[model samples]
Target: MNTLKWIKRILMALLLIIFLLLMAGFVFERISRSIAEKIKPDGQFAEVENHKMHYLQQGKGGPTVVFETAFDPAGHLQWYHIQQNLPKSYTTFSYDRSGILWSERGANPKTGEKMAEELHTLLEKSKAPKPYILVGHSFGGMLTRFFVQKYPKDVAGVILVDSQYPADEKYLSPQLYKMVNQGLPGGFLKFANTFGAARLMFKNMFPENNQYQYQNSVMPALLYKSADATLEEQDHMKSVKTEAAAINTFGSVPLYVITAGDKTKYDSFIKDQKIKNEMLGAWDKMQKDLLNLSTDSKQIIAEKSGHYINQDQPEVIEKAVNDMVEKVSVQ
Candidate 1:
């Protein structure tokens, strides 16, 4: 009888502890969300269809430069530094795709084609001028290509920064490929973010030397949105190849393919040296192929940079955009 009573008491204590923890998590989540809201959002929203798309615009006059983000959840924030430094004569804009950052969740099947179409509408509604220069980084490169293929006359030039090729997966080993393509379960991320656990985990993930507080403040909001968007895009990866096939050539539109020079950095992620070399070679070949999209295209190597050339060597990207603008002006 005493043993049974003791067991009941212990179970009750455990339950009470869990209930308190849950309450604490709820309070923490509210606090974290309040902090996130205090941080200023980068841009305003343009009504596209029934949803709102967030975008930041700066400068005026010259050919408008539209910046597309990588697979990052933070969206427009990725181009904050570069956009700020752009020449005042040239207008620059950066925007978050639907289901990212401040943008409302979009309709189902968020494929590349759908994304590009939405962007077209958003630009038109926002009154951004025509004959625009499009710049895409990483996965965004594919979207930019689709945009040009769909609306060739609207675009003045293309800049691909460490962009993803349709054949990019072929270079990776089966394990590495799976790891890269597979995303975390969206529901789990949502749950963590709702209770502020995701924010806590991310806060610890960054090193002490990393002083980027902007990212930390925005991570909680990005946690679920980024994961869901990434998974949705991964589901439609096959469509990218179809889009690439349709655009056989970019005509005379000036194209710039910026390849990262530091392939060895990926060695840490890939243990085997030979496989790393093979992956680097495949990436280089694929980037070269991107140049074939236009007769006037050229490839520049960001000598000291890795995948995030804008972060590592902002000068390279800035110079490339400036050069493209000058070239477009002459034509």
Candidate 2:
């Protein structure tokens, strides 16, 4: 009877500790979220299918440049420098997709086509000047393909910045691909974030630079809905690849492909030199293949940069967009 009583007491104490930790985490999460809302940068919101989507727009007038972001929750951060430096005479727009950053979570099965449609609706509602010069990075490249294919009329030209190759899976080892896609499960991530684990882990990781500080400030909150959204995107990538492959060419549409030229960037992810070399070769081929999308297309290598050409070499993107804008303006 004494032994049994001791075991029972220990179990009860453990349960109580867990409950208290959960409550504390929940409280901290709520407080952080509230504070983040108050201090974060202001962005316009649009209702898309009963959920709010957040967006930032700079400059004004015709030939709008619409930026599509990669897998990160803070999507707008990808284009901050370029968007700010673009000519004020031309409009530039970037947004957090559904369930990312300030945007509210939406319905499930967030496929590429569905997202493209949502973007169209957002554009219609926001009244952003249309027939845009579309710019996409990483996963956003896949989205840009869907957008251009579904709403070809809304696109004047395209600029792919170190974009995801639909066939990337074939090049990368299974381990690397899984590592890249299968980040902590969305449910666990949300739970962890809600319980303040994510916040606690990354609180000190924020950059000191004021320009980018606010961008990183919102990350702890991002792992909630955005993690699920990212997983959904990864789960449905096969369909995305199939849909993107349907477009054999863009005909006369002006296209610019900015390839990240640093082959050594993958060295960290891949150990075997032989496999890394093969992957690098495949990447180069895939980038060059993007040029075939349009006869008017061109490719510029960001030799100093890795996957993030915008951050490493913003001038390459700015010059490409400016040149595309001029080309489209004449036509």
Candidate 3:
């Protein structure tokens, strides 16, 4: 009788422990994050094409501007400051492309025209005033050209911020080609995988960067986006990526390319010296390619910045953007 009693007690204790752990995990996984609650982002949400998209809008008037972000989940977040600072002189639209923030998760490789097509639809749907300025940063910058080609009549101007060019592919050293052509995940990705790393990164250790660096609340969206990019549809992207390569190879675009003149911190993650050099080399390509893109184009080198140029130098980008905006007005 005593032996039976001890076994029963032990089993009961084990069961209780299991129950508690389950409850804790459930709480952690299901609970909404604090940051998600912080900003309402004041934009219309839509079930666009294969996925839902969250787009924020502010200001009012001519030159309706649309912002496309780099391939990050919280891409819209990167432009928060710039959006706030720009004179609502023209209405601005910043959206979470496909699998990005607040947007429903879905499969999509996210080609330039496909993305631009969605924006094309978004433009028609929003019924926002016409003559749009399609401004892209990094990958977003590439899309600006793609959008202009697809909707030649619709665009008023374009701004490329320290962005990749149509010819960026030509300069793609074998190493950089593996990184971008393979279309891997963004650099700060690990920051989303761990709580401790996220803490260090979110402390603004990186500028113009959201604190949720390691904690990607938007990954489900990325996975789905990558999964859904159809190969046939990607044919256009091949040309787009190729044009980017050619642009880099020969240099082209009625462009403004901002090069980050800063060096990487060369810590553990930063230890990838080959990667560091390749990225810098590619950065140099922006200047060369833009000159190739347009005779009247200008290249501004931003000092003390990383791949995330606008984050570190928003004022610099804003001034650059304003200059581009004014230049477009002149054109």
lDDT of 2 by residue, 265-299 (tens): 88777788887777788788888888888888989
- TM per candidate comes to 0.86, 0.86, 0.69
lDDT assessment of candidate 2: 0.79
- lDDT tens per residue, model 1, 98-118: 877678877746777778888
Better of 2 and 3 by TM-score: 2
The superposed Cα distance between candidate 2 and the true structure at residue 82, in angstroms, equals 2.4
RMSD of each: 3.4, 3.3, 7.1
Model 3 bad stretches (over 4 Å): 1-27, 33-41, 50-52, 105-109, 165-169, 179-240, 243-254, 265-279
Cα lDDT tens digits, model 3, 1-331, are 9999999999999999977865664444334244334445446876667666677777777667778776454556667667888888777788766645555545554666677787787767776677777667876777776677777777766666767655555676776656655542333433232222232233342333354343243333232232223222333455666655533311233456677777663233435777877766765765565665555566777787766776667788778666666766666
Global CA lDDT of candidate 3, please? 0.61
